[model samples]
Target chain A: MFFFALIVKPLVLFILGLNKRGQNNLPVKGPAIIAANHNSHLDTLVLMSLFPIAKIHKIRPVAAADYFLRSGFMKWFSTYCIDIIPLDRKNRVNKKALFAECHKALDNGDILILFPEGSRGTPEQMSQLKKGVFHLVKDRDDTQVTPVVLRGLGRALPKGTALFVPFNCDVVIGQPVPAQEKADDFIKLLASRYDNLFQYCVTHQEPEQ
Target chain B: MFNIPQNSLYTMLLVLLFLCIGTITRLVLKAKFPQKDYTELRQRIQSWWWMVAILFFALVFSKTTAIILFALISYLALKEFLSIVPSRPADRRVIFWAYIIIPFQYYWAATSWYGMFIIFIPVYVFLFLPMRMVLVGETKGFIRSAGVLHWAIMLTVFCLSHIAYLLVLEDKNPQAGPIGLVLFLVIMTQLNDVSQYIWGKLFGKHKIIPKVSPNKTWEGFLGGLVTITILSGLVAPILTPLGFAYGLLAGLIISSSGFIGDVVISSVKRDLQIKDSGSLIPGHGGILDRMDSMMFTAPLFFHFLYYVKY
Candidate 1:
């Protein structure tokens, strides 16, 4: 975490030119979920850098176990450097056990960063969101779910490519959505909130002078 | 201690005085008018202080530092341009190569390699980038991508580099040196912008180009032209080898070309259908918004001085 704050945060902000908006929406204390769109590997790094370095230990990005923990080195880096909460993607029988760690993190007042897209998608294009976020927040009406929209990172370091290009990225955080009672209602509310925040990333046609 | 040129020192002091005045005026405005929101004005003044400090150190430190600073500015300007402009996914590698050209271009300017600095972008990279894009094999939007990328390089890198080149020019004026020339051009160009805004607010009636830039007017244009021409004439003898008459001509070139540059960028924003390029600066918008005039003034003023004196 010390190494990340000292090195990775500055390096990511400098290279990516992270232009953030509505940062005040980020919950100062957690038991909260920061749900953002997934586009690139740099997404996790960029999101982590947004929080204060002192709370680095309290922020945990919920990543896929198989993908992030594929190799020995990646597992070490993902667990230690990024401090991610690895959730098993293939565990179908024990869904309840899969979310035990997430529930524990929330109970302990830690912020969990979740990309509801489940996996990386095409550059600059939003994909179908997974229902895992709804599962995590359902029945926990007190836990705040903040919707964040990330644009231009896919172009910078999109999936299936190792070459990094410097592109200016926008991070738009929206007001937290109240947890809905039904799973479908919660998912729909989250998606709608995302759509609203995503509008901030779109370049509107300004009236000509 | 670095031997600061006499004219450069005097110019720095003048800039400091202006900044102090701006601070006082901002404070007075806030205190006197409690209801009025002075956020934009305050942010503009704050950005000005930062810009002046950065430019001051870059000029005072050494020639290498100044060149590096301009190179970084070119990088930022180009980044902001590329970010706003429509680009194809296939041209991603092409964009990477475009950024790679910045350092090499600045290197030529820093080493005083006039041969490469002049033609490297226009001749070599102009031809080279299209070929690299062709190799990517995405024929769709090929021409548009090539045109956009090439133009971005020209405006951001090729044009802005002239200011850095000014610092490396042979010291024809022993009293002022190259730093003075830089200060003179930058100050005159920015002064023309501020003077035009003030004059336009006071007496501007006739719209110059309503379609592109509605705010610009004939009154403001003429006011800025006269103000900059006289100011340039006054400062040229102190800063450059040009006499008062030649200085007026230099002023004429900078003021007119600066106006054209401002409108040209305005046209670009209109075409793109965006208000401010990016929110990099607090009140200024982006590096491109601030540098639109410099894009024209730097090259024109540099060449005019080179032709007349060097």
Candidate 2:
């Protein structure tokens, strides 16, 4: 925990040159969930880097079981260094069981990184959001679910691409929407927040002059 | 020059001192505000340890090693500054050229080509960057984009190159060599910032310029100036060729101009409506945020010593 949080994390983020905003909006302590728009594989790195160095270890990003857990070394790296919550992307996703794992994490008072859009894609393109995040926190009043939208990450490392574009990525944090009962409304509200956050990043681009 | 082993011992002692101060502060803060958060103070101390270690090792090695180390720092500073400024699609090629020229700029200093190193960026590259941009035919932001790119080159590469150039100076003082000049400039400039912050919080009544920088106060400015000037005079005898009087003058110059650089960067951030250039360091905003004062102080002190040495 000390080695990864202290040394390895800062070095990786330094090389990537990530530009993040609204980090203060992150709840200092979280029994909460972060629902972000995933772009490149770089999205997870950028998202975690924005966390306060001390509390960064508390974040357990939901990683695909097939990809991250394939090899022994990677399994060790992901589990120990990254501390990801291994959740497979497959048919049905076992809503009741999935809810249990995430609920346990939230119950233990940790932040879980969930890409409600379900998979990585280009920035600013909103995909249909899943209701896993909503279900995890629906009845839990003590938990907070914040919307985080990432821009420029797709250009940084696009889907189905191995090379980096060396772009400056921006992250915007949105206000936590009240968790409503219906999955349909919560997903709809999450999608709109992603759009608003993305719009804010684009419109606020600095002038060269 | 002082014996290399003795110098290393002294530097390690300085590092130990910094560690002590940081640990004591952390403990005191924790005791005083047990309920409040000390995340920032902890991160800051953590960063300071790495920074001191990096620099101590750099100085402990040969001159070539120090030059390479500073070039990397300049590269990081340039990358952070350029990333924040808006750019046109056409400016991409020119930006690449800017990165390419970083190694070139250091190469000149590494080989001690003073004549060309001083003017290449300001004269040749300055002209070349805009000409390259104009060739791209992006009329929307041709002039503005060219100006910003040119300024980034000057600030990040040209200004920082002076530290490398200090190493190239002819050996005239055995008591204090070029590396000492580099250390003195860095240490005094940094101490100026610390004292000002401390003094400002203690005795800052009248704001120097509320519009440009609200925290800068006459009390803080003068307090830092006088304290650092005296300290510079005290340290300069063993650190640089400049004796007490010149060192005092150099300290005054550093504190004042470094203030301008700090405020100017602040205004630029204010105009852009952004805070703290980037997040490279925890508790400290970014590379640019940390280097703002050093960027200004390096070149000024370099030239000041250059003229004095010649």
The prediction achieving the highest lDDT against the true structure is 1
lDDT tens digits, residue span B1-310, model 1 = 6788888888898999999999999999999999999999999999999999999999999999999999999998898888878888788899999999999999999999999999999999999999999899989888988999999999999999999999999998788888998998899989989988988999999999999999999999999999999998999999888899999999999999999889998999899877777677789987889999999999999999889888
lDDT of 2 by residue, B1-310 (tens): 5356443356457857979888898999899989999998888888877787787678667888888888988888877776667765456667778878989999999999998999999999998887887787778977788888888889989998898888888855565566677778888888888899999999999998998788999999999999998988887777777889988989888988788778878887887777777776888877777888888998998889888877
Interface RMSD, per-candidate values to 1 decimal: 5.2, 4.2
DockQ for each model: 0.38, 0.20
Report the C-alpha lDDT of model 1 over A1-209, residue by residue, as the tens digit. 78777887877766667667798999999889999999899888888889888998999999999988999999999988888899999996786899999999999999999999999977777788888888877768669889998888887888899889887777899999876778778778888888888666623211111
Screening candidate 2 with a backbone cut-off below 3 angstroms (N, C-alpha, C), the clashing residue pairs are: B1-B174
The weakest ten consecutive residues by lDDT in model 1 chain B span B272-281
Q: Candidate 1: give the clashing pairs.
A: none
Highest-TM-score candidate: 1
Model 2 chain B weakest lDDT span, ten residues long: B2-11
